[model samples]
Target: MAGRVGVVAVAQTKFEEKKATEHTAELMYNVTREVMGQTGLEFKEDGTGIDATLAASYDLFSGPAGAYMFLGYVVGAYRREDERVLEDGSLAVYYGAMQILSGHVDTVLLVSYNKESSVGKNLIEWVGMDQIYQRRIGLDFVSAAGLQAMRYTTKYGITPEQCAKVVVKSHRNAANNPYAMCCDNITVEDVLRSTMLCDPIRVQEAKPTPVDGACAIILASEEKARKITDKPVWITGFGSCYDHHELGYRDLADCEALTTAAQRAYKMAGITNPLKTFDLAEISEQYAYQELLWSEGLGFCGKGEGGKLIDSGKTQMGGDLPINPSGGMLSGLPVCVAGMQRVAECVVQLRGEAGDRQVPGAKKAVAHGVDGPAGQLQCVITLEN
Candidate 1:
């Protein structure tokens, strides 16, 4: 076997409107403590001595540069000189899992949280813009997504009403999610009548921001995972890829990165037909249209057919394929932690502990993550029973 990885434990805070003003490192340390406590791995013994340690986090939402500095101190890793920190929290968790799978570390801790309540909503887009090619034109994530959605609709011939249905379903499903930021039931008509943030994209269609939350997951090798917990969610496949950064450089209607990433994941997992192989999906749907876009990108549906698939109710909780049963990003966008939560949610579903939102008889699932404007970065993971 090349390498094996599994999630051993996970913990999260209730999504709040505002973060409690705790230092970014403090929040991460608490989440880390929760994960260690649950797994009983804080005091590992290896031949009469504890082994090495690994950790990572991002500083974007921490309101400080190198927020991990404080986190390392709180976690008792400050004295060690070998600990590594990746600035991007999502990438941090990605690397944490990689370390365990590659045999570099037997145990790894992945932590990510954000105080998004304090930053401007469009901060990422503003920073992602190129000063010479894309800045000063007032372009942000909303506008970029609006452009993508507009092009998707124009190419696929989807109507705004069709898009609103996604929001309607998301809210309906989110009502049962205790950690969801938006749990209120909303109708398609309500979504269409809601405030229009961008043409063809209403306020309800876009994910509301400023969600304060923290989450972490512990990962270990296959043998270690089996010994740690009775219920271990195996990571059968993991793949990530990046598209061209410039908006005009890639196709606005579809995601090439998604297709490539999914291929790698499916190959690793030995999956032939995704719709027939996977039981549920936790995709990065920042907007309703993205669900449609990604469904096609992931081969759940063909081009210009996602709308029809949704209309047929094939993706509902009890339908042939359940998508976003955790309410997805449509219910909450906790910034850095959102992607890892997708992975954790899939693990939760596979472990049969998803509570009311669990997918019945679900054995395999997919978790998708995206970053930057125009959907520049993408990651996909496939899990199986």
Candidate 2:
């Protein structure tokens, strides 16, 4: 782990909720080429190729066997000799990091693409709902957030006004993100007045149904990193964990998976108090209530105290622990690309390259991602200067 794996270059497309005309591959290729160009790595001119290529997009999002071949060409790794193009982009980043640490690869490229707009459903909650038990009971994703929000409010006395604040805060924060899919001057009243997608969880409270986009990040070992970029954001620690997929079997209010994952990440980074140790955070707030729920899961506050924590402005950019400076998934969700987008944003922030949305003087950041219905899968990565 000492050789050091750092993100050298990162690029992303503007997130949107619909892309009816363009193919997903077009965005993926554009982002990949942009990131590689930033690394000054040219295939024909440099002779050295990326040690590995990783991409993520579930089978349902893309039409069929056609998408794989499409990706092969976009990455410039189209059946290169015996080289394998990994399709699980998130897992690819995990393995890419392992390869760099294990002396197998000096550099790796991670890409993820998903177009929720192309699919005829609310891709966010639709994908997570149980295909059998839960979906049969009419348990869609918005209801999942509503259920969790209700549980959180009941357990902690979080009021509707407070929930409105989270929505307003996210939109206000997102206004600063140029690549964000949705943002505008919105007030707490605006959130409360919006159409309710699910009881207690309004349309504005939810991440916009993602349109289409792709993201890519170039990772290099210490030796390769120093040669490429002067400011390389080091990957100090990473942790991922999963909870019981059955929503009925677990405490809906608490994210034990996140707690455990955060603990491991903090341990690896040698951090004990996240509030005091980390300068900023890019938490996944797919729902307004989740930002509050995960704040507790991440140990930003005592159990049942996340509502109060937000009330005190402790998570604002100028506060003690700013969370979701990118406006988070609430602004946009490219499904598979969302998690990696969080990572790339952190790296950009760490490198002082986040143009208008940069958190002032940010040196350390914690990015979080969730997969599965009812928060079943969680990934936590801690990055530092």
Candidate 3:
């Protein structure tokens, strides 16, 4: 792709249960400062610093009418080009990349923040559902995920033990990640014996740890990227899709939206075989079973074979196609910031800067994120060094 938009620098706060001292604006400022400091760029209109800014935040979660009002001061968007995205933070990256590709900006600053502990998480999530039908049934992300997990496991004959393995792997991998919140060494037995939140979804198997964090990334045009950093992670391909809105109308076992999104990304990246093409994947596995389900959706394996893929040990750290070397979303990234963290992890690996969790000689990577009920909306981004 010509006029490539490359990730030159990325920054993120340590995932924690609560950022007690820092407010949402402070969190955003911290990450933005780090990225700007890394690039030695300022917010100016004379083509000397970031040409534009993109931010992501939810008004309900941030407890403000216009959440971007808090970020504009930190991102230095007072009199510059700035826009707010109401979806996942990864969408900012997608939109920023498009702006660069359109020859409108040389450098774009992207930032996203979420403090899950500051609000009633359930109330915020419930508001996003279909108020007429899904909202009254008492379904949030967890219950919706449970519904998908039960269906996927039942149809594919995936056992509870298989799902437990995903949790074990996530925590084990997170041990090397200083920014991850859940890095405890756990076993499949521990997972199986943990509290059961819903049928087939154990407390450990679900997002066991909720976190508060912020992430920022600097995207530059091909010309400016080479000057900003020698190891620029290029955004080669990206795509997003939306599935059925209502849970009753959709097939929970198959992630048609995710598959279509991945296929669109793979086609743009000239990747014919995803299983052998990318060195690693950073998936937003909101639940233990999602790792297996999303692996199938990403075409790492055939349909209903996610369990076989796990059993093959191919997704292990030293295995053929390692998945979530940074422990992924299971390690406790904030809800809206989850996908942006995946993109940051990919940038770290592609730059050969992941100190302990580095994938050796990794040149290409895929990062995924989903929103809405039961993975209704999906986004896939492919990056290369």
Candidate 4:
């Protein structure tokens, strides 16, 4: 597919487990400033620069109402147009592309941040659930993921050892990443020995909490993209979908939302066989099992074949298709920032800039993101050189 939107510049700050020194504005500036410098672009009144600003952050995590408003000012959008999404970085970039596709803007500035240390994760997610049933039982993301894991494992014959491999691969890959947070050279036995946060979900399997980070990206129309940078990572296709909010209403073992979203994106990008179409992937897997579960939803394998896929050694470094060469969210990317960083990592790989963990001749890549208990909402973004 000939792309209409392209990402000309992308930047991200080193993610930390607890970055208490900087405020949200500082985090925004840290990345936005770098991106602007890369492109030498600004918010011009004559419509030659960034015409729209898109941010991925929520009032819950931000700790204040209209947090995006102040963030916009810090990025030189004081009185200019700005928008916000209560989703992940992939969705924000998805909307930014829409801004250009809709003829609303030729250029868009995308930003995403989450200071997880500022607030408690469980309480925040709990409040978002149904007050009468789900929240009353103290169901948060971790616990919810446990329920899903139980069903997925039991139904598909997936083992804890298979799930443990994901953590091992993620941290090992992260060891080579300069911006990732968790990069211990741990093994599968170490993961099985780690404390269990939720039944069937070990502490090591989940992303270490209280993380803080931010990312910024510049999206431009095909015409403006060529003028902004000689090399542009084109946004070939994207899609998103929402599942039933109640756990009882949906199949915990299946990622229906992700399947629909991937189908939509694949259709737009003319992808008939995902495992063959994508040279690499950067998926937001907050937990180890998600890498397996989400991969099936992405059409990399048949349903219930995630365990077999991992055992095939086809997704590791130097494999036919690598998933998350930049260490991924499992390597410490913040919630709101992971999706965009995935896209950024893909841009770097596509540009031949990924120093050590680069996939040879990577041209087409997929970046995925999701939110809510048991993966209630899902989004997929496909990119190419």
Model 4: lDDT equals 0.89
- Across 1-385, the per-residue lDDT of candidate 4 in tens digits comes to 2349999999999999888889988999989989999999988989888898888886788877776665668766667788878888899999999989988889999988889998898888888889999888888888899999999999999999999999999998998889888898899999999999898999999988978989999999999999999999999899999999899899999999999999999999899899998889999999999999999999999999998888888888988779898888788988878888999999999998888888899999999999888999999999999
For residues 28-96, could you state the per-residue lDDT of candidate 3 as single tens digits? Answer: 999999999999988887997899998887778888768678557787778889888888877788888
Worst 10 residues of 2 by lDDT: 80-89
Candidate 2 local lDDT, 1-385, one digit each (tens)? 6488888899988887777777877887888889888988754424265767666666577766446665666776654421332232444555567778988767877778887776654543565577878767877766777787777788888777777788777777888889887787788888889998877788888878755888888888998998988998888877778788787788888889889988888888898999988888887777888888898989899888888988999888788987877888888866667778888888889988887778888899888877766567777788987
Off by over 4 Å in 3: none
Indicate the worst ten consecutive residues by lDDT in candidate 3.
Answer: 64-73
Report, for every candidate in turn, its global Cα lDDT versus the true structure: 0.76, 0.77, 0.89, 0.89
Which scores greater on lDDT, model 1 or model 3?
Answer: 3
Q: Is candidate 2 or candidate 4 better by TM-score?
A: 4
Report the lDDT of model 1 for residue 54.
51
- What is the model-wide C-alpha lDDT for candidate 2? 0.77
Deviating ranges (above 4 Å) for candidate 4: 1-3
